[model samples]
Target: MQFLVKSARPETLKTATLVVAIGEGRKLGAAARALDAASEGTLSALLKRGDLAGKPGQTLLLQGLAGVKAERILLVGCGKERELSERSYRKVAAAALAVLKTLGGSDAALTLGELMVKGRDAYAKARLLVEVLADGGYVFDRFKGDKAEAPALTRITLLAEDTDLLACERGAAHAQAIASGMAFARDLGNLPPNLCHPSFLADEAKALAKGNKALKVEVLDEKKLKELGMGAFLAVAQGSEQPPRLIVLDYKGGKKDDAPFVLVGKGITFDTGGISLKPGLGMDEMKYDMCGAASVLGTFRALVELGLPINVVGLLACAENMPSGGATRPGDIVTTMSGQTVEILNTDAEGRLVLCDTLTYAERYKPQAVIDIATLTGACIVALGSHTSGLMGNHDGLIRQVLKAGETAADRAWQLPLFDEYQEQLDSPFADIANIGGPKAGTITAACFLSRFAKKFHWAHLDIAGTAWVSGGKDKGATGRPVPLLTQYLLDRCQ
Candidate 1:
């Protein structure tokens, strides 16, 4: 899809469709008022006749209004004029785009970017508008025999004032990059396990680096992993016929000497809980197990596109945890690259096993900070539901920075306590620590397990088990979360 910035009155812009906002109390915003007057109070008359109520998410479509050049007009409810929050404004934008999608128009001009959102600037408004459009416009029918026709709404023009045009353009560009990154992540997560294995992930990473001078890709096979003493990570891969991979992506866009921000991801391409096998029910959704890794690659895709002036390294601990004779079983112990021993009381607790080894590897970078993303525990889903990623970290300052990034991006994270008390649950008499920290505070314990390996750097962990993907319903697919948050954090630092 294409995006543009238009600096003109809504009624004067010639387009297939014109989108404007109406407040809940039947009050029209500036653009809507101008168009309404041009059409001799057509919007007001329709509201009075009960044809349209300006409730949030409510939309009305009118064709060939008296004085409008556009073939159609879409009126989206923005809730109360005085109470138009950012969230509500997003809803308004979504509603407007929904109408445009069904109109079969080639393009449309939206003036909703002019609407005032509390504490949000014109750039943010424009960015959110295009971001919503790109997200909503996503279609994943590649596997469908009877695929739907391509959407007719291909180009979108966001109306903004002359003074705000540059910011709007910048915001739109960033939003497109982010949305494309999200789409990339979702595509990787939604691929069938048969298709998106460890090798496939490595290939994808290499493909991403192709022709991109700013990015470099490297992959480590089973032999290389063993040479590096990643026994914990190798244990998970031994069960799968497809070998494991430690995928590294180096994005060098900053000053030559700057210490890079390192990101580690647990890439359990298809986790069947290893020998401690998960129930058959919902096991198919395990394809999303690698979403953490997908997010890292996705963030790189965006950062490279934005040409962000910040060094970043993505370390993906890619492997498959299948239940086979070779699979690491309960009561097994494996040593990590850090030479730290971990008791594998349950094979299903393998994400941390993969991450522990990789986290230790990350210290070699001497990074400014290291953040690992993983769908590490179901307990995180139970605690935070599917809306927010569970955040835990050893460094309060880095944790707060990530939390703030999540907030700014609306890809939020709720910080769970990383208190030393939670670390006690990970104690093991047999080894340096145990992989599973018994069931209580399971998410924190998982983070605690990784914290031990990340002590050398400013580190934070995002347990995205809940927010990574949906398990059922029509919307069941990868959400491509935290990419927005992670990207925003890097972007902020670049500034």
Candidate 2:
């Protein structure tokens, strides 16, 4: 979708439709006195009942205002004025797009622009809401046989007639980059895992890197994996005929030799639980296992698009864990790219296997800090629920940065403990450590296992297992999450 900003009067807009967020009692911020006279009671009576101003995410539509040029007006609620924050207002923007899904118009305007943001500047707030509307408007029905053509939504004009509006304009460019990148992320996640296997994902990364002067990408195949002693990661790929791939994407917008921020993502295209096997009940959702990789790849593309003044390198470890005789079985011992042997007690505990070796590869970069996201454990869902992700890390500063970023992006996360005691559960009698670290605090032990390979650098782990795929049917699957959070965080705090 294209976005534009103009100083045209709301009455002068000759588009097929207009969208403005309003309240329940027809309460509205005066649009600088002039339009107020022409609008008359249209704004007032609309707010009289079923007004769009009652709360965030609430919306009502008004047709043919007395003297307005637009045919229809989309009134979206912004909640109480005092209660509106940047995040809340972003929700309002997202709600606006959601309400417009079936409206059949091409151009729209958000005249109801105001900020509920604090601490962050007007630039950041404006950038955030525009980005939110772009991200939330995504719809994925790729293979649906019977689907309506998506409505033609070409432009969203955010009105900036107020005093602090310059900040919103300043944020507009960055917001454009964010929304474009997120739309790319949504496409990656929505593609069928079969069509988007390991090699395909590597090709996509390479294609993206090839187009940019500031970025470079490399794809490593099985032979390279063998040379690196990535037995643990390879063990999970044994069952698939489709070759395993390690994709590394590097963005250099900083000092030529500066150590970069490293990001790692788990790329399990289709996980059949290998030899351990999962019940057939909800197995279809496993396609989202690669959400972490999609997020990382999406962030990489976005950073390059935004031309961020920071150096970053991203690694996506791709493999398909299936059930074949060649697959690693329970009780097998395999060493990682870091040269640490891990006992495979459960084939289903495979995500860390990929992430551990990938983390090991990040060490070669000598990064300033490292952060990895994965659909690592179900226990995270049990602990934090679907609303938030579980965060655990050895470095407090890194984790705090991630948590703060999450809050700013509106994709929240709760920090979970990484106690020394959690490491004990992974201890193996026969090898250096065990892959499946029993039942208690499964999420922490998984982080502990990855920590074994992520030595020295400030590193943080996000267990997005629960938040990656929303099984509730109410929410769209693969939240296209942590992409916005990770990207926004790096843009803000990584400098």
Model 1 lDDT per residue over 1-495, tens place: 999997998787889998888887788888888888998987688888876678899988888688888888888887776756778878888888778888888999988877787767887788877888898888788799999888888899988889999999998999999999999999999999999999999999999999999999999988899999999999888888989999999999999999999999889999999899899999999999999999999999999889999899999999999988888989998989999898899999999989999998998889999999999899999999999999999888999999999977878999998888888888889998989889799999998898999989999999999999988988899988879999999988987
- Which stretches of model 2 miss by more than 4 angstroms? 32-34, 45-58, 85-91, 115-121, 162-166, 472-476, 493-495
Identify the runs in model 1 with alpha carbons over 4 angstroms from their true place: none
**TM-score of each candidate structure, all chains considered together:** 0.98, 0.92
Q: How well does candidate 1 match the true structure in TM-score terms?
A: 0.98
Clashes of each: 0, 14
Most TM-score-accurate candidate: 1
Task: Tell me the whole-model lDDT of each prediction, alpha carbons only.
Answer: 0.90, 0.81
TM-score of 2: 0.92
lDDT of 2 at 384: 84
The numbered model that scores best in lDDT is 1
